[model samples]
Target: MTDASISHLQVLDWGLLIYDDALKLQEALVSERIAELSPDRLILVEHPPVVTIGRSGSLDDLRESEEAINRKGASVFHVDRGGMATFHGPGQLVAYPIVKLQTKDLRLYLQMLLETVAAVLRSYGLASEFRGRNPGVWAGAAKIASVGVACRRWVTYHGIALNVNADLRWFESINPCGDPDGKVTSMERELGQSVDMAEVKDRFTRAFCRIFGYATPPEVRQRPTERPSWLVLSPSCTESIDRMESVLSWLRLSTVCQSARCPNLGECFARGTATFMILGTICTRTCRFCAVDKGKPDAVDGGEPERIAQAVQLLRLKHAVITSVTRDDLPDGGAEHFVRTVEKVRECCPDVSVEVLVPDFRGSLKALQRICDIRPDVFNHNVETVKRLYPIVRPKARYQRSLGILEYAGKHGLIVKSGIMLGLGETEQEILEAITDLRRTGCSFLTLGQYLAPSKEHFPVSRYVSPAEFEEWAQIARSEGFKKVAAGPLVRSSYRAGEMVCSMRQPLKSYQSKG
Candidate 1:
């Protein structure tokens, strides 16, 4: 296995893809796995209609000619797998495991694949068994899943495909596994009802991991729902997280990092950096996009600023980031509380630079001026999303009012900053327009991050913005005049806050042009 230790396996969902493209991606990941540049990964995807022939099969196995298959909208391929002939199409769940082999026995690996599929079927109240002579999972007399694989450099690809709710008619065209009398079935056919594809994938992932001995530690919480492998966090710093949480609890303080469920919590906590949240965790505004609790807030704790300042001193942070939940109930929209916190933090650590991601102050220029007057090193207010998505994403937060907050801070000679979340049903043109609008307000720093829905009740993610696209947007933001930009899948408004100042003092590799 290239002499690399086997860590916990990761699961990635590629959604819907074409067969050829998926194969190409598998080859690339296999190379990376062989070179020890990547860990074992399970790639989950669904492909369009197609038929594949394994090394043991020929054109005679096909019931129809190539032209007839094409007319049925199904293409055929000659693959390097060990099976005969099989059909792959929509409504079927395909799992291609890019894994480094721990043993050279291909038979054992195939047995593990069969056991995993059997376990998943058992979870859905369906009994499945593998007939060694048949080489696939069967329910009584009909095949419910297919197993085939290809290997290179001791890494395996082209794994099992389970029939979730696929139309079995496609199987009629090919004598499945070169047996003309073989019967094909699916989960829906066995249960007499369609099953939830998402749930089946979850069960299959857990079963596969358990069967392959890649189980996650009990201490680690499960990864977020349907997150791509890159976005999933395999937290290896539980002691650090426990220590930080304990300290925050002992101090009677709160952090935006915990309240917002930020993906960077483990990384930042391990490094002894956190964004303090003042004015309590409960917010008065009911913004649909935010994860903070919505309700009547608790009474403002007058000593909260001093406690926060103590935290800054104890953490010994060179750059402190403070943010809060929107509190429209307060007359000043909690501006005075923000001012007090900043003052205490500055008094406690004279050398530390401060940044505050504030709300819009309910369009109160006077309250906005109060925060601006403190002149925290950086002043930030996120427009959060494109204007067109405002009503749906943040019904209570006005887009124009947020821009005005940034503009007012910029006009007052403060280093103004703002942020936005992508994957909220916003188009490319809308994103560019949003960036231009922020630039017009003289926003010096910008953060563009992917929006992850916290739960099924929250807004669903329209798409996952890729890393290359984030970099391209960063380049565009720089050309649009944003002095510093942090754009990526896991980036948040206060992510890497210290780096912005450091970049100003010297060159940072993160901001350097890839070109």
Candidate 2:
């Protein structure tokens, strides 16, 4: 006989089915054929109505009784997926692939599934990812797709349940995917709109084919080409950055410059300057550009003030910049911690000037008073961007409230400073207006820098500001009555901050001497 031709290998089109009862029947059929099929078959099936319990699932998680489930005319079955219980009903697409893996690695197989689903979701204008330790495509903490599978004799059965336009209310009946507190969400929930089931199925099928190394069917391969740049630090700088970061880790402190994934982290760390993020890493409000984990606040760490002081002392920092996540979750927006931290830094490092970069405290005068009472050497609050971009750029913060905070600090005898990021789709006039607003607030110092996207998942950068433009902006800010201005590509609220503050103080000191 002629040598066996691999070119003659059959390329089977993925079979699609849409019915509630089809899941149980198809799963049983795939499981039965696992050992018998010479070449594994790939089947894509959609569920009409069902609840599934995975290997580690518990019946107690189900709010409805077995009789209640039966009465609803849906069946519940145990699955091999590595999650807890989940509800699948009409309008959800469930894909079951019964195929032998080209590679025997289960992890790689799972990654392929996730990438495939992510590609499909991208086509529909949804941004999603596989969160580490989480077994689904999440648009934050909400689950949009669930994957569960059983592999035996190197053949895979069971698969993923993607929530397209499913009624999410059904998921609330049980602790979805097992955790009682776990929140169940769908594509419709995130997008605030419905998607066509046929379109979803067709797009997903093409994604699966492309991912599995099969030639894409001509009709489904036209993917949108909008690649976002991934912001990452160079590996050569990791050692140097990590050495500085070791100090923060030792003190259990957080830095938004790191946590928010600032693009200039390497340069700052190499220079041995770090922006100390206090009041814990958890933020109260969710902003689109920020990467800080948002949720209910953590309790204030009383010892944090002293610890930060000790770190500043140990690092021999001549000027220390302290900042915090938006702590609206706290009654005082963590202003007390800011005050205490500033005080401790002053006490311990008597020669070190303290600069505080703080939130607006939800426009609370009392909170502003608490921080001002500490008399930080430099009281800096960022306007972040122009008023026009405020809603989209800093959704939870108010531009007026921020300006008020700066003015209040200045009026209270503190050296007030403010900064804004450019390249956020803001116009030059808007920038000039913002500079004028800062001046009206009595801000003595202003810093400006480009807004580089921290992650692809975050907001895209509208443009990058060149060095020459930054210098011109700095000149404009100075002419607009800012006592000192620093604007450049690498400029940040705390960039080369000690030198800048020292330069500003020299002129003030000389003027006082002359007086």
Candidate 3:
């Protein structure tokens, strides 16, 4: 065959085949293409849990012995790829592109593969970027999809493995691609929803066609309709919501429940408890999932604290939860605003326990120290989703930095609390890992909630978590040595801050004791 590019690509969907079987099929297809008997082919398949070491990999990367590995219902195989050890399983999506190269430039071909996967993720509202030397798409600190390929007779095989909804626990058995520091993340854990494998396959297929310049468009996969159960407000809740709105309007204060477009706003407001956003309504950051207005925010209002205090006093709130939009523009990240608000609330109603849900303060120790020094009843920050989704969902935030904020407050004997949203496409393993990370930060009170899309323009909802799952995680968190665990569909960081403070007055277990 001459070195001419083909006009069309043949994509074969081989569902759940073993590694050896898929390898044989790839060989046959490559031979067919070499002989110019068949068009170039793309093989999409799922392998029943196995670890594959590439040509450049060493045995040191595999942690488990061959016998022990078999006992766990898995196997290790050597492949002809160019990377180190990596695992593949049922939930992960694997694609082998056996296309004849146009110019025999293997490096360029590999880069195109990464771009193709990144493009597919982008369409699903996931933002991934190519690192300088890394051969994968990164969602922040975590590697979501990795590429390892080989070119034989100018045809490519052994493409990319995207962790769509895989259990990340399998990766703990080895240093994936020989990188121990960078963690692995999945679509399910990041998006807080279960993804349909067929749908992901279709999306990848379309992206593959477009990137490789296929003349014909592939079949478009219909997106499954999202059905978030409509929450009904009780009559009492309606009356309370009205009262909460009037008080908030009277004071000209804002609540995150309103600005962030929380689904449980009515219930929280009606219950006379609202997570007040102390700073202006406009946020400095553009988190894709948040509905809070993003722009140059209004200057810090000197009288904002007094109005917030008045709102708390008028509502007779036993606990006042205050949070602010991240103000990267500020010198102290609005730390003074937080401190002054807490002080005003305490002065107005001494009985009101204050919980401050704060930002990372851009990892400034002085800013963190200032918030900690205030001695609020509870110092809270959300690790948000798992570390993997930070770039896609929260582009400007750092996962470890957020943890450090909690650790700093926890070490100071503050009642540290944190929360994460479910159905952001986070795997069960990632959720457990995030909780463990939070627990290490001296966080005892945990809140886990379902993430609802504020609007069509915002990040799409990936999954709706069941009430049972929330209860299950709450029980898991409590059993894991947490002092108080609030896990439910509608649970927010400060929605039940008062009850948590009133019912559980004990200090959190120290980081050392948590072990």
How many backbone clashes does every candidate have?
0, 2, 17
RMSD of each: 19.2, 19.1, 19.9
> Could you give candidate 2's per-residue lDDT for residues 451-479 as a string of tens digits?
76666555555566777889999999988
Return the lDDT, model 3, position 325: 92
Best by TM-score: 3
lDDT of 1 by residue, 1-515 (tens): 22235856767687776787677567766766777755788888888999999988898889989789989999899988888999999989999888888888788988998898999998888898888876989987999999889899879999998999998999989999989999999999999999998888888888787778785531111222356766876764777678777778878999998888998887777665678998999988766567889898998999998988888887767778889988888999899899888888877987777888998888998898787777778888999999876756677888999998899998987788899999865768889999999999989999999998785456656578889999999999999999999999999988888878654432122221111
Which candidate order results from sorting by lDDT in descending order?
1, 3, 2
After superposition of all CA atoms, the RMSD between model 2 and the true structure is: 19.1
Please tell me which predicted candidate would have the highest lDDT against the true structure.
1
Better of 1 and 2 by lDDT: 1
lDDT of 3 by residue, 1-515 (tens): 21335756766776776777677657756765666655677788888989999988877887777677678878889888889999999899999988888777887887778888888888889889888676888887799998899887887888999999898988888888888765999999889999899999888888777777775564221211445453333344567778888988888888887777666667666555679997798888888777788999888899999999999999887777899999999999999888888878877997777889998889999888878777888889998798766766787999999998899899998889999988765668889999889898889899998887777566655567878889999988987889988887777777666778787554323211110
Give lDDT for model 2. 0.73
